[model samples]
Target chain A: MPQIAQLAATYSSQIFWMLLTFGFVFFVIGLGMVPKVQSTVDARDKKIADDLDAAKASSAAADALEADWRAKENAARSDAQARLAAAKADAAKDREARLAAADAAIGEKLAAAEAQIEAGRGKALGEIEAVAAEAATDIVRRLAGAEVSSDAALQAVKAVI
Target chain B: MHQFTIEPMFGTDHWAIGGYNIAFTNSAMWMVLAAVVIWAFVALGMKRQLVPGRWQMAVETMTGFIDNLLSANVGPEGKKFVPYVFSLFMFILCANLLGLLPLGVIGSHAFTFTSHFTATGVLAILSFSIVLIVGFARHGFHFFSLFVPHGTPGWLLWLIPVIELVSFLVRPFSLGLRLFVAMMAGHILLEVLSSFVINSANAGPGWGLMIGVPSFLLMIGISALELLVAVIQAYVFALLTSLYINDAVNLH
Candidate 1:
C-alpha cells in the first residue's frame, strides 16, 4: 500500500502539522471556550432556582396577606353583628318603656275623666231635685190655697212621689 | 494506492526540517483542515446563551458527551483531563468524517490522515504517555500492579502478570492500528467497489446492469456503514484511552 510506501516521505510532516493543529484546538477550544460554556450553563441553572424560590416566597406572602384580610373581615363582621344586636335590644327596651309610660298616662287620664263626669252628674241631680221641690210647693199653694214648706214638699216628693 | 500517497502540495523540497523532507503534504493539509474545522465549530457555536441555540447545543453536546464518557470510565478525577480527551476525540472524529466527504465529485479528494498509522500511532502514544505519567506520578512503583489482576491465584500469578504486561504494552499499537486499519480498509473497500462499478459499466450494458448496479448499491450501503464506523472509531479511541487512564490511576 502507498500508505506504507510513503511513510518515510510523509510521516514527519503529518505529525508536525497534526501536533500544531491539535495543539491549537486544545488551547483555544478546549481550555479557553469550554469553561465559558459550563459557566453559562451553571449561571442559568442558578437563575432558574433563584426565580423559583422568589416565586414561592411571593406566593406564600400573597396567601398570608389573604388570610390576614380574611381574619380581619371575619372580626369586623362579628363586631358589626354584636353592635347591631345590642342596638336592637336597646331599641326594644326603650320602646317597651315608652309604651308602658304612655299606657299608664292614658289610664290616669281616663280615670280623671270618669271622676269629673261623676261630679257633674251629682251636681245636676241635686239641681233637678231642688227645682222639682219648688215646683211642687207652688202647685200645692195654688190648688188648695195652703202654704207648703220646701222641706215638707221635698219630704212628700221623696216619700210618695 | 495512489489515493493513499501523500505528495507535497508545494514544491517537493520546499519545506523541510533536519533534512527529513517534512514538506507540506496533503496529509498535513487535511490535518490542519480538520483542526480548523473543529476549532470553528466549537468557537463559533459558543454564543453562551442561557438557552442555547442549535449550533451552541451541538457544541455542548459534543463536549458533554466526552465529559460523561470520561466520568463514567475514569471516575470523577477524569474531569481534569477533559480538554486533552476532548481535543483528541474531536480531532480523530473530524479527520475520519472529513476523509469521507464526497469531494470526489469536484475532482478533489479528501486525505484521511487518521488512516495513516504514523498519525494514529502518535495519538495513541500521546494517550499512553499520559497514562504512564499519571500512573507513576500517583502510585509510584506500585503502578506496575496494573499488570496484576485483582485476586489472582498464587500459582497463576506467574502467567497472568506476563500476559497482562504484554497486553498492556500492546495497547498503543493496538489502539493506533485499530483506527488506521478500520479507516483505511473502509476507504479501500469503497474504492474497490467503485472501481468495479466503473469497470463493469465500461465493459457493456449487460455487465453494467448485472454487476455495476449491485456494486453501486453495495457501495452506498458501505458508505453509510463507513459513516457509522467513523463515529464508532472516534468513540472507541476515547473510551479506550479513558479506560487505560482508569487502570493507571486506580491500578485495577
Candidate 2:
C-alpha cells in the first residue's frame, strides 16, 4: 500500500524519463540500426545471385566453343578425303594412256618386218630357174645335134619341176 | 522495507509543481540507467557485418524476436507499431535486470524502478490508450461493439456487455500490476533469503556453512528464476500490447 501511495509523489519524473529514454531508443533503432543490417543481408544475397549467373554464362560459352571446334575438324577431314580421291583418279588415267601407246608401236614394227621377208624369197627362186635352163640347153646340143631357145628350155624345165 | 521508498536524489525534502510531485528520485535514475545500457548495447552490437559476432547476434536476435511476436499477433500491419513495442520490451527487460544488480546505494537493499506501480502503470496506460485510440480511429463507434458478442441471447446481452466493459476498463491496471508485483515479489524473496544467510553467518562461522550454504544455494536458484521471470515478464507485456492492438484493429 505504501508503494501504491508513493505513485502520487514520483509519477511525473518517472514518466518524463521513460518517455525521453524510450523515444530516443525508438528512433535510433527503428530508423537507423535495423536498415543497416538489412542492407548487408540483401547485398550478400545479390552477390550470390550474380556469381551464379556468371558461372552459367561461362559454361554456355565453353559449350559453344567445343561444338564449333568439332564441326571444323569434321569439315577438314572430309576435304582431305576428297583431294586424295581426285589424285588417285588422275594417276590411273595417265598409266592407261602410256600402255596403249606402247602396244601400237610394237604392232607397226611387226607388219614392216613381214613384208621385207616376202620380197627377198621371190628374188632367190627366180635366179635358180635361170641356171637350170642353161644347163639343159648344153646337154641337148651334145646328144642330138639340135639347138633349143632359152625361153623354151626354161618353160620345159619349169614344166618338168 | 527501505528499498521501496522513493527519496529525492538531491537534498530537497519537498519538490512540487501544480500539486504534483516532480522530484527526481532513485526510480528515475534507474530508468535513465536502463536506457543508457540499452543504447550502449545496441550501439556496440550493430557493426553491419556479413557475419555477425556475439553482440550483433544478440541485438539481431532481440530485433527478430520482437518482429516475430508483432507479426504473429497483429499480422503484417503490426510492423508499424514496432518502435513502441520494441521500446517497451527493451525498457522493461533492462529495468528488471538493473534491479537485480547491487544498485541500491541509498537503501537497505537493491532497488529496481519497475518494482514500483507508478512507472509500470504509466506504460500500461500508454499502451491501453494506443489500443483505444487506434480502435476508435479505425472503426469509429463500431469499436464499442466489441463488448457485444456475436451470438449473445437477448436475455444475457445486458449482462455480458457489462462484464466485458469492466474487463476492458481494468486491463491497464492489470497489466501494470502484473509486472510491478512480479518484479517486487521476486526481489523481496531474494532479499529475504540473502538476509537469512547473512544472519546465520553472523551467528557463527561454523553455523554459516551449515545453514547459510543451503540458503545461499537456494537464493542462487531463485536468482536464476528471477532472471528468467524478468525476460518472460517483458515478453508478456509486449505480447499483451500486441493482442490488445489486434483486438482494437479487428474488433475481436
Chain A TM-score relative to the true structure, per candidate:
0.72, 0.50
Off by over 4 Å in 2: A27-161, B12-19, B103-110, B149-155, B204-210
Tens digits of per-residue lDDT, candidate 2, B178-208, equal 9999999998898788888999999999889
In terms of docking quality, how is candidate 2 classified? Answer: acceptable
Residue-level lDDT of model 1, residues B142-247, one tens digit each, is: 9888888889999998899899989999999999999999999999999999999999999999999999999999999999999999999999999999999999
Model 1 CAPRI rating: acceptable
Error of 2 at B117 (Å): 0.7
Interface RMSD of each: 1.3, 2.3
Candidate 1: pairs in clash: none
lDDT per model, in order?
A: 0.89, 0.82
What's the DockQ for every one of the candidates?
0.48, 0.32
Query: Best DockQ goes to which candidate?
Result: 1
